[model samples]
Target: MKIKAIAAAFAATVLTPFAMAEDQSDWALVIHGGAGVIERGQMTAEREAEYRAAMHAALDRGEAVLEAGGSALDAIEAVIHGMEDDPLFNAGRGAVFTAAGRNELDASIMDGATLNAGAVAGVTQVRHPISLARAVMERSRHVMLQGEGAETFAIEQGIEMVPPAWFFTERRWASMTRSLERLGLDLPERPEGAPELQGVDHGTLERDEREHRFGTVGVVALDSDGNIAAGTSTGGTTAKRWGRVGDSPILGAGTYASNASCGVSATGTGEYFIRLTVASRICALVEFQGLNLQDASDQVIQDELTAMGGDGGIVALTPSGEIAWSYNTPGMYRARQTAGGDPVVGIYGDED
Candidate 1:
């Protein structure tokens, strides 16, 4: 009788931690806007409330999917697609204008189950770039397609395509004009004329140029099935020329996923990110070097990317229900929630 009691206690002890881990895995989702200087004083109460509401909506959508036993890929796509439709973010309908005054969107998606990936770049007519990215992964033979070719593929695949003007917004247009002015390019003046300022000089111009370097929105999720997935979308950089492409459309640079490891989404200077292979490097460090998710992300974003003079951040989630949110910039628009809990959202470093 004593032996039976001892065996039962041991079994309960061993199952406790597993039960805790299982609870943690039900639905973990995280999202981020581009990292930049987000000052609380500059944001109005109304604007802050809007951001909070948007993030909460995203968290709820993903949670619903997990609650229904959906895959991580489905949950990640649903959340990101919702953000793409939102004008407050720089993606899909709300993308910034290119140098040619047209919207050029890019997007990528990765499946941790098979490690398969898909991407689209320089697409102008696709209504939801994330949907096109998923189609590229599941329906098409190519991993990436660009420009008109991508639009053509999107149409053939029955994805929604919108008119070019549908993507234009007054705020994004204003941002593009400012970017062009900072780069010393001549642009048509606003109807109200430029505002007169005191003491604005070359230094201010240089700073403005640097401020426009970051752009993109992403999501990383761990579903109830213990699978991980990541998705990223962007309108590319403002005033970019020569059909320029950013890291958001690239697989290893902008996003990565592995069922045995983690999913990562990066936002920053795409050039430096691609050279560093930012997303894949994080997974490699964690899997090969035995580093935890947080340490691996910090070492890459702070030590590696910062060392290269690149400023940006990454959102990552491990299969074991761990979340790693790291960035070297002054702030990053980010939100996170585990399972059915309340979401934590922030725009600046100090808020963290």
Candidate 2:
């Protein structure tokens, strides 16, 4: 009789902690607006303020969702929607022009709880590629779609569509022209019906804005239900050609999430991120190698990615509400917020 009583008490002790852990109100969200050689000297004070304000607005959007018990997927998608509309970041409207003088965007989304994912690449007309990616995950059997086919799918799914000209930004066009000139290639003709460049003072990209040509925007979140979700969006690299698809639309490369491991959204040199599987590789280190989120991120970004000569960074969130980020570049535009905690934003590498 005593043995039975003791067994019952032991079982209760072990099970109680798990139940409490499940009920904890822990939630977190992390976001990044590209990474590169961003130094204080290169950024004007006005430009810096604009970036910080955008990050704060994004955090507020996501925080409201999580605080209201929204799913991690919804929270991140909401945050990314605002960034996609804002020309301050390079995802949707401000996307860089390709070698063909077109804006070919790519994006991916993953739900950690189910391991379901979707992606779209080389999409030109979708207003929000991230939303299309999510639609693919929920409504289609395929994992990825690209180009005209993806646009057709977006239309069939009632995803918002925009004229290609709507994506044209003078800054991105100037950057593309300069890139082509440097490559000693013939300049591309402007797309049909492109709006005339207006209110642009400089024809050439400033040093600080040079890296903006390679920017991407991403988000990773862990909700109160302990589900993790990650999403990434980009306009590939400036002057990309041959229907090039970067890591942003590739699952397990630039974007990955698994409730058993971690959620990751990466921005960097797409080829290197694709080769190293940077996103999932970091999560693998955490789940399989028993490394904490920070150590796993460091190992993947600082050690392995650096050895491969990759330049960029990643933001990761664990089911346990841990947030981590690592970058090999001079700086990464990043932000984070947890339930009941203040939002913290960073741009320069020197910041903690």
Clash totals, every prediction: 0, 0
In candidate 2, how many Å is residue 281 off?
0.4
lDDT leader: 2
Where's the lowest-lDDT run of ten residues in candidate 1?
A: 1-10
- Model 1 Cα lDDT, one tens digit per residue, 133-156: 999999988899999898988989
Worst 10 residues of 2 by lDDT: 1-10
List candidate 2 stretches off by more than 4 Å: 1-23, 199-204
Q: State the lDDT of candidate 2 residue by residue for 184-231, as single tens digits.
A: 989989888788766554522666455564589999998888899999
Best by TM-score: 2
Pull out the clashing pairs in model 2: none
Give each prediction's root-mean-square deviation over alpha carbons.
7.5, 7.6
Task: Kindly report which residue pairs in candidate 1 clash with one another.
Answer: none
